[model samples]
Target: MTEQPDSVVNDPNNYKLSYRKLILPVSLISAGAISFAIPPMKELDLSAKIEVAHDRPGKTTLDNYTQYFPAVMVYGLNLAGIKGKHGFKDRTIIYATSQLISAAIVTPAKSLIAEERPDGSNKKSFPSGHAATAFSTAHFMYREYRDNNLLLSLSGYPFAAFTGVYRVLNNKHWMTDVVAGAGVGILSTELAYWLYPKMNTLISGKKKNNKSVVVPYYQSKGVGMSYLLVF
Candidate 1:
């Protein structure tokens, strides 16, 4: 008779995993919060000016793409039925919360920084909302499906990168703003995941082992032989 597979047990310390996950985000937020609070270092402020000037061509080329990104993300999430899944439901909350927080942080920063845009046109140029939105969506996608497949995991990088590029192309934000926005987005998503256990019913549900088959193949005497086993 085939032996029964040994059952796996969930660790009582699983909640500890949540704390561990919180570390990087908390650190990032701490860094960003501190940096935003301090007066800009002289060299850093100069560098921002140079980068804005150098990035003009890119900003001009990619400006058109910025307007459509949010609409695209909304349509994609709605069509994908992401709202139906527990992980994604938590992700949506995180995304919205992060955006709101970033907006709050950014609005005042922009008003105070009064940093001129690359084109010298607008007053609010610090902390690109487009970059924040992009990073937030990329992070949300990463958290929602990171465990599902390798392909999904790889897809997030391009989206985030494109958003940053678009922001630069539009001359809507300085490089510093984009970096800070990215940090905010990633940190916010992590914070959401850390809080999920407290708010979502799915986290309280029974944990089950998901199984997949492993196959090994060998070639001998011009023929192929294979063996399959459950994992």
Candidate 2:
């Protein structure tokens, strides 16, 4: 963790829940929900769909892959020696947990809502799964690196936003669906962060005192990692 300068040090206060941070994501969810009832908001969704359908940009599979880029950046940055707030094991587990949570939320909504895709492809388009996963990973990246560099932390959002926009451009989801998915994704990631410590404790049972770091090396023959055990 010392490798990441300017990060918040582990402290009791850091564990205290901050409701203030909940405002934006919660508002996003509420707005998406309210869009269903409000005529103007509902019309806005329809207008967005029509516009995309009329002039859909070059349909690329970039959205499918870009969703995971932010999370990948975290690991790549770590390997490049710009560590974030957590170790590889910790960050990976948290991100995986976020994925599970986002899936849990998005999957059921897709089934129950039965909203057809803009392309009439299927009845699973109320919330975009890709958008949810994209934002979840983006938020994961943001949370890990926010204290280190604000710009670096925010770098994930462009990818997330692109994922959401392309879902519409590809006629995969409606505007409101993307917005709601983003809300769910952000909430899921936040929950994972809150739950990580408890989950780690439950699994470990005992505080881990041993210290070790794994360093990967590139060589002519083969690539391997060196495990350094520190007393």
Candidate 3:
């Protein structure tokens, strides 16, 4: 049988790719590459930016909060007894890995490409990190719930879509930037899914680590995380 993305394999020897699962990430990446390489598509990207700018829609900070809705839903649903594919630790690790991978890819690319934002804010705009984060979490939610509830699994996409669209609408990114970010995000999650089993094996094989407590602190305008090491 083909290995499912949500399958928990504690053995690194069982690590394998499921080609069927590659469709979404591959198609997105291909589309992104085409958008970057093809003249007509590049024109489309510019036209899209211009058209949206012309609309003069009032920019809102909604995207900031909504981008993480899918990931939040994953945990919320699981907590409410709508069990997902993996248990708490496994799902958390997978989600964290996906976020890490997406950040690692997007951060360096932003520095290297230095594409300016539509609003002329800065040059860290080749790929929309917000869109990338949205799609990565959306894909993570989908992978966890796809087999059981297809509709519910897909519910996160509209939010993800909105996040990407708003990145352009808010003049924070170009259409092509959002497209590339979506591709990168999905690819990140895909890689996380593939690597998680191997990672789990390695982690499980190790001796228990020292205990620690993570405390979340709310500050003036942001949240802070601190850890207490236990000997």
TM-score of each: 0.57, 0.82, 0.81
- Model 3: CA > 4 A from native: 1-15, 34-36, 205-231
- Count of clashing residue pairs in every prediction: 2, 0, 0
The residue-level lDDT of candidate 3 at 5 comes to 36
Query: Higher TM-score: candidate 1 or 2?
Result: 2
The sequence of per-residue lDDT tens digits that candidate 2 reaches over residues 1-231 is 334332222663543447875777787777777876898998898999878778887898888888878988987898789888887556655776777777777777777878878788788887777887788889989998899998999999999999988888988888988898888889888888887776555645443443444433221122345564533
Better of 1 and 3 by lDDT: 3
lDDT of 3 by residue, 1-231 (tens): 222233356565433567766777677756765765689987888899889978958998888877789988987787677888876556766777787788777787887888788888888887778788888889989888998899999998899899899888988888888888888888888888888876666656443342343433221123345554433
Instruction: For candidate 1, write residues 1-231 as lDDT tens digits.
Output: 232222222332422336566565455445534545666743464576676567556335443353224424542654565331233233333444555555555566667876676667876666555555566556656665555544564466576777776665565555666666666666655655554455345433433222221211111111122332223
- Clash pairs (backbone) in predicted model 3: none
The local lDDT score (0 to 100) that residue 213 gets in candidate 3 is 33
Q: What is the lDDT of residue 58 in candidate 1?
A: 33
- TM-score winner, 1 or 3: 3
Order of models, best lDDT first: 3, 2, 1
